[model samples]
Target: MTDDKIQELIGRCAERDVLAFEQLVRQFQSYAFALAMRLLCNEEEASDAVQESFVRVWKHLDRYDRGRKFTTWLYTIVTNISLDRLRAIKRNRRLFSSRDEDPSIDDIQDERDLHEIHSNEELAGMIRALTDELPLKQRLVFTLRDLQDLSVEEVSEASGMSIGSVKTNLHYARRRIRQRMAEKYNVERLES
Candidate 1:
């Protein structure tokens, strides 16, 4: 939808129009869920994050600034909520030490050779798994800029980082990811 249309929906939503709010949710829920999934890495947590984000949006519709892009605002909200959930999960895991830790890059053993992987999905999964090794800042920058295809400025806005920080983080993230991919797959042609 165009920005104008979204602005209209927001205007209606500010007036407590349930139908307009529902329409807005229908239009953006998938994008929100996808982002939450990237940030949280768990389907159930992502779903809960998305739901909580919408509730926050509903309550704060009137506070939204019209000058900013609506999707950017939505992304900011989703990113914040997902980060909160991630931190909470980390705290909970620490409290309950019996939980199985997430697998490390060394733990993933694939029988098929890299060349035998025919689908982009499989390649993406491998790369995503490697991202788990990255520091949180690097991982968020990589996921937002490379995986989510957001521009540096957009990533800065969503992640609450400066544009220079976004670029620096992205640079380091890509270098680390490329290094990991090369070590694991023994393929040196991966682009930076």
Candidate 2:
């Protein structure tokens, strides 16, 4: 959908037009859900987070600034909600664990061959393991800036991090992931 149209929908939402809000939800729900899934790593939890996020958006529509990119603001809400849910789940898991099960890196299913645009899921388990090993901030920054293809500034804004912090985290995240990839695949990454 066009930005102008989305803004129009937002304006209508601010005016309490339920249909407009529904339209806006329809336009962006898939992207939001995908982001939620990436963060939460579970379909059910991601669904719950996405639903709650839209409700939160509706409740706080008036606080949205028209000058901001709608996607960035929307992503901010989704990321925050998903991270909160993830933290809660992790806390609960640590509190009530029996046998320790290590979810380590493994091989991937090589499907599509993506070019230098960035790596694709050559090995799904390996990629996920590499990502999961990252600290939360680094993981979030790496996913937002690289996987989601958001600009550095956009990721910083959506993640509520300073631009410098975002860059640093992304740098570390990518370097680590690449190192792991090299070990797993025996391909040296050229330093850029």
Q: What does the lDDT come to for candidate 2?
A: 0.79
lDDT leader: 1
TM-score against native, each model: 0.86, 0.84
lDDT of 1 by residue, 1-192 (tens): 988899999999999999999999999999998888877777788899999999999999887999988889999999999889887877887788633456445545743433444454444455447687687889888888887888888999999999999999899998987787678767656343
Best by TM-score: 1
Using alpha carbons, what is the TM-score of model 1? 0.86
The per-prediction tally of clashing pairs is 0, 2
Q: Which digits, one per residue and each the tens of the lDDT, describe model 2 over residues 61-109?
A: 9889999998988999999999999789777877885324424444332
Residue 67, model 2: lDDT of 93
Candidate 2 structure, TM-score to reference: 0.84
